[model samples]
Target chain A: MTDLDLSALWVSVQLATTTVLVLLLVGTPLAWWLAHTRSPLRPAVEALVALPIVLPPTVLGFYILIALGPHGPFGQLMQLNLAFTFTGLVIASVFYSMPFVIQPLQGAFEATGTAPLEAAWSLRASQWDAFLTVISPIALRGYISAIVLGFAHTMGEFGVVLMVGGSIPGQTRVLSTTVFEHVEAMEYGQAHALSAVLLIFSFVVLLAVYILNRRFPIHAS
Target chain B: MSRLVAQFDVRYPTFHLHLDLDIPASGITVLFGPSGSGKTTLLRCLAGLERAPHGFMQFGETVWQDETTGRYLPLQTRPIGYVFQEPRLFPHYNVRSNLLYGYNRIRRDMRRIAIDQVVEILGIGPLLERRTHRLSGGEQQRVAIGRALLTSPSLLLLDEPLASLDIQRKQEILPFIHRLHHELAIPVIYVSHAISEILQLADRVVLLKDGSLVGVGTLNEMLTSLQFRGSFGSHRVGAVLDAKIIGHEPQYGLTQLDFSGQRLFVPLQPSAIGESVRVHVLSSDVSLVIGRSHSPTSVLNVLEATVQEIREISQSSVEVLLDIGAPLIAGITRKSLVTLGIKPGDSVFAHIKTVALNEEVTD
Candidate 1:
């Protein structure tokens, strides 16, 4: 493979890894609140989070580009430029992959119910203790699925990253954008090789999830 | 006497509960009621799991909740152990870790119950290393109880702990619960709708119906009270007599019990003489005879009783509450009542066809 291909692959790996880590840290509490809270705003917030799933990637990328530009609210307030940067790409990928990480975690938390937590409370576990000792272990499967889906979804981002990051080599360029560039350049051989790698990687990650999930059923009594 | 005083007035959309209770601080005090009768709600209130906005509860010196003073202790802070109907063991933890979950949380000096003793009492030694998902329903409950006991709480709340178990599983757990009553000094407030469990485990019963406290009394007092019987269904109508084993007739395979001044015979009991046993005699098993009939019969217990009151149960049947030193109820036909001229204050002979000895109870 060419150095550009290696650089694009490395950038893609870094972006996916960072995005998944950020989602896990940020999404856990958000997913937990969505699973438990009965507030009227819960549905509104959930719908908002799930918006990117149905909205076209280009639309999300366009809105994110506007929000992070020097003229937009964030750039105006913070006096920082993020558009056409690696950070902008990461932020866009996180938004595009939001539902993929959150929905599974929310389902897992809801399925656990409050019975075990109440049981833990009666046994002298504080709320925090119960979450650590009881809840986290039970919701481990959700974390696994969230990480796999979130990382895979971020790796496959093309339209959103291209719109925000503009295919800058070794900085903003990633495998999906490079694949597009190769196909546009009529280099079918490079395009085919990159597509095959992505296909195998995605298949292996999904297969591992299904097999592990079946082996350790989440709802075992 | 050490006692728990609880006053709760809760208003929910579907139900309203208002109760005042003074429960003895030791032995098993059963909260008996039908479904949606607020038994479990009362338990939750006592455990501080359900906050009653205008409630007050004090167990001995501990003030769990007093809304007037704006003092309320959350569940984890209260010295209580609760066993829910479902054995809510941590599915991720093995039996040993589940038991230790509470045991390790308390300060070492405040740990009143030894882990080994709890394991022995619940008979969960063999299942300690097993995963919670692998346990049978009965075994899971036993481990739950053991886990609760190891916490060394001042009070234990058990909300229909046996409700989810089958008859055989209930039988498996009942002995362990019985042993817990005898072995521990902690006050247990057991909530159940089952009559047999009340008859077997209750030293005192707090009867509730439709969010109201109907009565609170000893097992014998409640069982014999017509008001209690009326609240319970007709099938559960019975009398509980405290009788002492006086002698054993090995040849006849019978044990003689002395109740008040009357001698009653029962199937051979494992307990020695002088041990008191609670005998549950269903009102339907009692047949009344005027002026002591001198005829050969299969009945073993024939006692002279004074009719305290007679209440018509149905068009055909009447319930006669008799004072045989202790209260004993007999369900007789209205025709027989009229034929024999049985009325209030009339002396009669109560021929008990069967007296089911409640062998599960031990004081």
Candidate 2:
């Protein structure tokens, strides 16, 4: 602990955890809406969910900073500046990792199948009950996969966090940006240790998710 | 009052279907038709799975839909039970969970059906612990029925529930449905293309063809009508005659049944006398005679019959349909018809022997 520099490693885990939690809460309804609604505006809603996947992380981070700056709409309304703050790192991570959490959930919901849902509906269950009791449990594995991908993607983020966080000490500096600062200072040993830890941590998390997902038993009723 | 009424028309690329329906308040009313007759579309409409352009379905005070009133009840809100061709049991649930999925979700104030009785009636009690995928085709179907019945629906819709099963498997699950009809007052709108299913299960039959309604009647009328005769052909065409068992011979395993003051001998091997039995007489096995034949042969039912019409059945045989106070049909070779000169209004004897009449289960 004394030899290894972990100041930015702790910040990265915090940013990844908070961003995954927020995306899960927000992406659930968004993915469900995309899968269910058939209105003419469905295409527009789908485009909004997909925009993050195609846009470069730096470009997305720039727009997000403008939106959360002191004079920007949400920031001005909240009477606070979020850009280059700890809060800015979370907001940027959420925008960059939105697609990873939502797309898999949408596919899983689609594959959960319609027969069991319809059967539950015919059994006099309300729509909410049918989804909770029938549809959600069937897609539990999908949710686990979504959370893992979102967390892992946020952990590895570089451009978005760098553009928004601006490398504040003990505040917004994450593991990826911390390595950049160490490289610029010609401190190769500290940079190598942090980068290697990030790599191994991400690989373990993703491997554990996939192996656990494969081993979970799905009981056919 | 008509508890269920739906009139809708849908256009498809290959076929056009126009459906107008009014079913009874109780018992099974089978929607019978061949493959391309839009039977499933009608059921899906009733289930609210398909949207109808100009459709209306009402179950008592609850109005399911009326395009004029700008009201449509989705499948979740409607008090309807549906059993599809394949058993769509929740793959993640055990039998008990699937069985109670609807039962526990709905308000207890609306509960009218006894869950235990439904489990017992379908004979799925022992199977309640097993997973759905482990069950046989017959067991899966029974669970599907129980799942629907536990909903306590006003009307049940069955779309060819037994079409996927083989003969013996269908035979196994059919008795449970018959018991359900007797035990519960909910009217079932059954759909099937097999006439034997219509005979054994349906109290009323609504026949369809080419996406149009052809005939609607009881078992006797549908079996006797000329329109249905064309659908069933000469082979599976048979009459389900309700007769009182007069006597039974424990030795030769024969039973005598009386219908309209006429005695007929069948291999019922009835266990109890005075029990009601159903006898089927095929049109092909019946041989007609002009006068009283002196030959003492195996022709058990050589009763007097009047030739009503000489309908050309096939290239080689002409069906001599008879009405000897009871509807009877006989298919004879064209040579026999030409030699005997049998025409309409001629008296004859319909020799019916060695015919297959299965033992039917009736309440």
Candidate 3:
């Protein structure tokens, strides 16, 4: 593979890994809330979280581009232009891959029920301690699914990175965008090599998830 | 003795629980009731799991909850251990780690219950290396209890810990629970609808029926009361006799119990001489004799007693309460009542057919 293609693959891994980390830190509480909240705003909030799944990637990318632009609300508040940068690509990927991380975590949290958490509380574990010590271990399958799906989805992004990050070489030129660039330049040979890597990597990730799930069954009870 | 006092008024869509209680924080106080009776709800309220809008609870000196001032101590801050109907063991850990989840959380100086002591008391040493899912139902529950104890909780709440188990499993776990209060002396609020459990384990009983408090008293007080009988269904009406093991006739496989200057015989108890135990006698198992008979009979227990109260439970059956130092009830036919003409203030011989030694081993 050419050095540019190798760099694109490396960029894809970095972007997927960073996106997964950021999503987990932000999505965990959101997913838990979605799983357990009784507020009337729950359905609306859920609908908002799910918008990225059904809405076109270009549309989400367009809105995110504006939000991170110099004059937009977030840009004005931070006073740092985030558009067309690695950070911009990551922020867009976080929004793009949110449902992939959140839905599984929410389902697992719902399945875990409140009994074990209550048991932990009764045994003198604070709320945070119980979540870390009890809920996290029991809902491990959901975590696995969330991390894998979020990473793979972020790796496969083309339209969002194209709109927001603009395929900057060695900066935001991820594997999917590189594949697009190769196909556009009629370099099918290099495109096939990178596409095969993406295909095999995705297959390995899903296989790992299934194998882990089989070894440690979903119901921890 | 310190008391755990609570007042809760919770209204669900279809049910409401209104109770005001001041119970001694010693021994096992059972919350006994049928399903939908709010027995579990009361326990939850005490544990702060259910935050009743109109509620106030105080354990010893700490005010755990008070809705008026909006002061509510989260359950984790309360020094209490709660075991649910299911074992609720942490699935990710082995028995050893599950038992120490709470133990490792508290400060070193605050750890009163040593892990070794709980393991020994619960007989879980053999299973410590095993995963929780690999353990039997009874074994899992024992580990759960051990986990709670290792936290050094001052108050323990058990909500039908045996309700999920089958009969054999219940029997397997009951003796372990019987050893708890005797060994540790932590006040336990145990919830169960099983009459047999109440008879075997309760030091005090709080009866509930359809979200209302029926009565609260010592086991004997509640047992002999008509309200308890009504709640328990009349057929379960009986007396709980606290007795001392005076002698064991191993040749005949019988043990002798002494209660209030009266000697009673039951199937051999595993307890030692001078050890106190509780015995249950079903009212249906007793028959009255007009006078002391000299003829040989299969009945092993015959005590001279005076009649106390007679209530006609049915058109054909009458429950005759008798006093043989301690109160005993005999369910006899109305025909016998009329034929023998038994009434209050009369002297007679009470023939007991069977006696159940509560299988509780006091430490």
Candidate 4:
């Protein structure tokens, strides 16, 4: 596939891995708060988290690009170049992949029920400990599915990656953009090879998730 | 030295749970109530799972909650071992790790109960290697108990730990819990709706009915009292007796028990010599006679008992509760009472059938 397309593939992997890790850190607590909090602001917070999923990916990327752009509030406040860079790609991927992980995480949190949490609380496990030890472990199957789906979804992104980061070799160029470049250059054979490789990667990840999840905490059913 | 007092008012979406209770700091305290009667709510409040802005909970030296102060200790920080109705073991860890998850968190030199002892006490040795899902309902609960105990909780909160099991399974798990109550120094708050469970397992029972406190006392005091029957089904209605198993008569298929200087013959049970045993001499099983029956019938158990009180149970039946010193009640037909002139304070011999006796009790 054109000498393994090392730079594009490396950048894509870096972006996907970074995005998943950051989302896991940010989304774990967010999903937990969404699942548990009884505050009146919950619905609004949930809708805001889900906005990236409901709105077109290009729109989300555009807003994020503007917000993180040099003249915008975030960049002006932080004094950092966050648009059309590796960091920007990661940010855009995190937004695009959030609902993928958070939705499944919320489902898992809900499935854990109130009994165990209460049990852990009374057993002297702190809220953090209870969530980490009891709720997280029990809902681990859903969490794994979320991780795989989120990583795969970010890897396959086109519009968000394109908007936040147009083709910039080594710096921002990813597999999705590389394929677009191949198609534009009329390199159908290379495009076909790369597409086949991406299909295999997605299939393996999804299958591993399904098979492992079947034997996960809640059991086969 | 101080007692635990909990008085709480809870407002829910549909129902209100109002309870006033005092649980001492020793023995297994059972919250005996029917479903949706605020038994669990009371437990949660005691455990700090729910904070009603105005509820009051006092435990020994510490004040857990006082609505005016807005003082509350969250459940995780509270030193309480809790077992929910379900096993609720972590799926990621095998039985051993799941147990250690709590144990590892306890501060050094703060370990009151040893790991080996907990594993031995709950008999969770074989389960340590197996995945949580691979374990049976009873096994999972045993591990759950082990996990909770390892935490060295100040109070153990068990919300119907035996409810999920079948009759046979429940029977198997009860003795382990009985040992927990009798052996452990830590107090327990057990919530259950099963009258049979309360009879088998509780030292102190706080009875709840529709979110209101009804009765609180020893099981014996609760069982014979008129208030206790509303919790136990009418068919299951009977008196409980605390008796000392004097010895066994194998040839006669009877076991002899002594209570308040009265020697009573009961059916045989698996018991050690000089050990005490509780017997549920169902009121319905007793046929009272004014004079000691010298009839040579196959009725194996006959004891000289004095009637303490009598309550009308049904049209044809009268519940004659006896003070065999340790206390026993007999459900007899009104015809037997009137025709035989069975009255309170009347000394009589109670004829009990052999097969009616069950062996699973603690006196």
Best by TM-score: 3
Model 3 misplacement above 4 A: A216-219, B287-298, B304-306, B310-318, B332-349, B358-363
lDDT of 2 by residue, B58-94 (tens): 7766778898897898888777889989998887888
Number of the top-ranking candidate, with lDDT as the measure: 3
Give the higher-TM-score candidate: 1 or 3: 3
Interface RMSD, in order shown: 1.4, 1.9, 1.4, 2.8
Worst window of 10 by summed lDDT in candidate 1 chain B: B354-363
Q: What share of the true interface contacts does each candidate keep?
A: 0.66, 0.87, 0.77, 0.58
- Candidate 3 has which clashing residue pairs, if any? none
Task: Write out the backbone clash pairs for model 1.
Answer: none
Overall local distance difference test of candidate 1 = 0.89
Span of ten consecutive residues with least summed lDDT in model 1 chain A: A212-221
Q: Write the per-residue lDDT of candidate 1 for residues B1-363, one digit (tens) a residue.
A: 888999999998999999999887888899998899999999999999899998999999888899999999999989998999999998888999999999989989989999889988888899989899989999999999988888898998999999988887886787678778777878889998887787778888999989989999988788777667665456768877878899999899999999998999999988899877778888999989888667787888999999999988899999899999888888999999899898899999999988887534221
Candidate 3 fnat reads 0.77
User: What tens digits encode model 4's per-residue C-alpha lDDT throughout B133-243?
Assistant: 888888888889988999987888899988888777787788788777666778888998876777766788898878889889887787777866666666656666667
Where model 4 places Cα greater than 4 Å from the true spot, the runs are: A1-5, A37-48, A51-55, A79-81, A187-221, B287-307, B310-321, B330-356, B359-363
Candidate number with the higher DockQ (3 or 4):
3
Candidates' DockQ values?
A: 0.54, 0.62, 0.69, 0.48
User: Residue A150's C-alpha lDDT in candidate 1?
Assistant: 95
Candidate 2 collision pairs? A220-B91, A221-B91, A221-B132
Residue clash pairs of candidate 4: A121-B75, B277-B363, B278-B362, B278-B363, B283-B331
Q: Residues B81-159, candidate 3, lDDT per residue (tens digit)?
A: 8899999999989999999999988889999989889988888999999988898888999999999988899999999
Tell me how much of the true interface, by contacts, candidate 1 captures.
Answer: 0.66
